[model samples]
Target: MDWTALWLSMRLAAWTVAILLPISVLMGRFLAYRQFRAKGMVEALVMLPLVLPPTVFGFYLLVAFGRNSPVGDLWQGLFGHQLVFSFEGLVVASVIFNLPFAVQPAQRGFEAIPVEVREAASCCGMSPLASLWKVELPLAWPGLMTAMVLTFAHTLGEFGIVLMVGGSIPGETKTIAISIYDKVQGFDDRSAGIMSAVLVAISLFTIALTYWLSARMGRRLS
Candidate 1:
């Protein structure tokens, strides 16, 4: 097995989760508690990555963040390197692509919190932030855990966007999925098989955890 690629994939997943967690919490809470116009449209935009073809999404990301693009130029000016084919680029792409996975469950978690509970927190002189940290989060942890687990596992197995945007730079952008593909292309079946099995195991665990969390959340809400 290409341990380096595995490590790189893990690192990328971690970064993606770290960057998305707070954003997920905020966005999820907003979507859960608020009734606003065009909410469905907002949700559709978030879910777009899940449905969109990875190759098409990656092409858009490449064009939007390429050296000639404004965002790319700005990043290059500050970072002294191009965003495309870099680890940072992969992190950014992963975060965007995994938005629905992270946000949707968090929304469900936050939605599980009863309005009366939030009102009671406020009546007890709790600030919005305090209510969120002390009252809301505890009640919604299972859903949030499901979100993070899904995001982490999905990030590990994601191949198209990473390949398109970051390429196969060893120890940099060559994630486990890409490594498996490379091994297969090189006719290294043993290595590919090992990595594939590892990913399959991770995916199974993720799904199991998600189901358990969903059940717990349902019971809590019920």
Candidate 2:
């Protein structure tokens, strides 16, 4: 396996996690607590990526961020470059592709906390934001961590969107999944196996970490 692709994939996953963490946390909290008009519709929209085809997401992203569209041109004007065919593009695609992975778990975590706890905090005159930061977030820390790890892992495994938006730019956008695909296409079975093994090891380690953390959190909460 080319160490470069492994490194690139790791970098991409790390960046994706860093970018998605706060956004997902806020979204998860909103979905859990906010009862607004079309709340169900908002939840459905958030879950859409899970059911949407990866290629279709990639295709739309390409058009939306490509050099021609209004948003794309506006971005180009501000950034002096296009979003498509770049690492930045892959980051955007990964965020969109793996959004639900981060949101759903975090939302569930927030939901798991009793409403009475929030009510007690409110009774004590704590602002909503303060209650969230001091009460809800700590209780949901394990779930947040799980969401982050899972989202990172899922993005690392993404292929179609990365290929479409980033164009397999080796050393920049050629993540592990794309590299494995290329190796297999070129009949380089050995390299493909090596990459696959690495990915599997990482995924297994993550799953174990999540379970352990969840159990620990359960004990602590109890």
Candidate 3:
């Protein structure tokens, strides 16, 4: 098994989850509270990753971040490099690809907060941010944990989008999922199986840990 690929995948998943968590909390809160025209359309757009093919999403990202495109040009001019075929590129792809897993769970968790409680907090003059930090967030811990676990798991298994944007550059853009694909293509079944088993074990352990921690915390809160 390629230990480098294994390490890269773990790194990517960790970073993706870390980045997604705060954004997910914000987006989730917005979706749960904000009301405006075209809100449904906006939600659909955010969820496009789930419905659209990963390749299609990856293609769009490639175009948007590739050299000669406006954002890409700006990025290159400022940073002195292109986003394509790099670790940053893979991270960008994974974030877009696994966003819904984080957002949806967070939204649901926030929604589970009773409306009257927010109203009561407002009656006491607590600002929206204060209420969110002191009241809403504490009640939504379980859902947030679910979001973190799901997002991490989803990112760990990401393939099509990462492959398209990252192009399998070893120790740079090659994640374990892509590495497993390379092993199969090379007829290295033993290595692929080893990596696959490792991924499966990690996923299972993460999910189990999330559940256990959440339950234990809930009991303590009770």
Query: Which parts of model 2 are misplaced by more than 4 Å?
Result: none
Work out how many backbone clashes candidate 2 has: 0
Instruction: Choose the strongest candidate by TM-score.
Output: 3
How well does each candidate superpose onto the true structure, as a TM-score? Answer: 0.93, 0.94, 0.95
Residue-level lDDT of model 3, residues 66-101, one tens digit each, is: 987897888788878888888987887888788888
For model 3, the superposed segments whose C-alpha errors exceed 4 Å read none
Q: Give the TM-score of candidate 2.
A: 0.94
RMSD of each candidate relative to the true structure = 2.1, 1.4, 1.3
Cα-based lDDT for every prediction = 0.94, 0.87, 0.89
Q: Rate residue 176 of model 3 by lDDT.
A: 92
State how far residue 169 of model 2 sits from its true place (Å): 0.5
Against the true structure, candidate 3 has what lDDT? 0.89
Question: For residues 1-222, what per-residue lDDT tens digits would candidate 1 score against the true structure?
Answer: 999999999999999999999989999999999998999999999999999999999999999999899999999999999999999999999999999999999999999888999999999999999998989998888878888998999999999999999999999999999999999999999999999999898789878977887787779757
TM-score order, best first, reads 3, 2, 1
